[model samples]
Target: MSSAEGNLTWEPATRHTELLAGPVARAIAATPSARVAPIDAELADTAAFCAAYDVAMESSANCVVVAGKRGGEVRYAAVLVLASMRADINGAVRRHLDVRKISFAPMDQAVELTGMEFGGITPIGLPADWPVLVDEAVVAAGDVVIGSGIRGSKVLVPASELATLATAEVLPLSL
Candidate 1:
């Protein structure tokens, strides 16, 4: 089954593995509710993709990788927030991670570790140990659009489904 949302046509992501990064494709294959849609790679960023597709900002979610350091150990996590809000990295996240300092992970590090493109990292296929911190608002937003682990396409899934990921923790993570 297929349908159109905004200006994009959506199909089961399992049918478009070529458009997803390896891990993401595998995750989607196991997630029955996820759908995929192709888009111009140049418009993959949240702002550009939302505008070009005529999608509401509140209906889009962004996944950000963050690094927190405590003494000699460093922890990495994926934070999910609505495109209309910002993640509370300095306060809630830093405290939650129990680290001395926390910041957005370097682009190269995030890309290298997640095995996904810089601008298209999604929380679905992150390293098994990484916490997937999802903002409460995002989980309450019903269906939302997110990166597909590749710049040429996007995934649509129920916000609540994200909260069900093994590593996910729904919290007040946004400011």
Candidate 2:
């Protein structure tokens, strides 16, 4: 367990405006050796945030939570992707979750169930049972940047370390 920054008090979104610290942050805490890193909270989206910070997409991990129903079974899945790629929710996710179909979760529904601000959600800290999928390429980038459980804060850690921290399963699933 190796942590990057010791305890840094960065301000996570305090309201429902842009981001909030939730599952992702909790995962950071769960990481035996990870520390939450600071990120500007007013980010519009992952691409914008990476461009503004000069963070390489390959090194930036993005978490997308998707929901859908198949054969009358409703399910939610979180896909951790590289900033350079997209989460192929339609195919890979549909197959992995074993859902006949899948789609991006609606805003209101995403917030209600995730208990997170819209754009700040992360796979970490999600209910223990939710399947979190990580792209193998993303795991190889090392020192990846990801949501801080809040829109404003992000956690920075070695990619390998992140995988270890989350017990994440890696596959070639990113689009």
Best TM-score among the predictions, by candidate number: 1
Please give the lDDT score at residue 136 for candidate 1: 97
lDDT string for model 1 (24-80, tens) is 987875467888988999999988998999888998999999999999899999999
Candidate 2 on 1-175: residue-level lDDT in tens? 2122223332322222233355554444455444454566776377777776666667677777788798798888778888878877888778888888788888888777777777777666676767778888778776666665667666665667656544467778876
Give the C-alpha lDDT of model 1.
0.89
lDDT at 82 for candidate 1? 96
Candidate-wise lDDT, in order: 0.89, 0.66
Ten residues in sequence with the least summed lDDT for candidate 1: 1-10
TM-score of each: 0.96, 0.79
Q: Could you give me the TM-score of model 2 versus the true structure?
A: 0.79
RMSD to native for every prediction?
A: 2.0, 5.3
Q: 89 in model 1: Cα distance from truth in Å?
A: 0.3
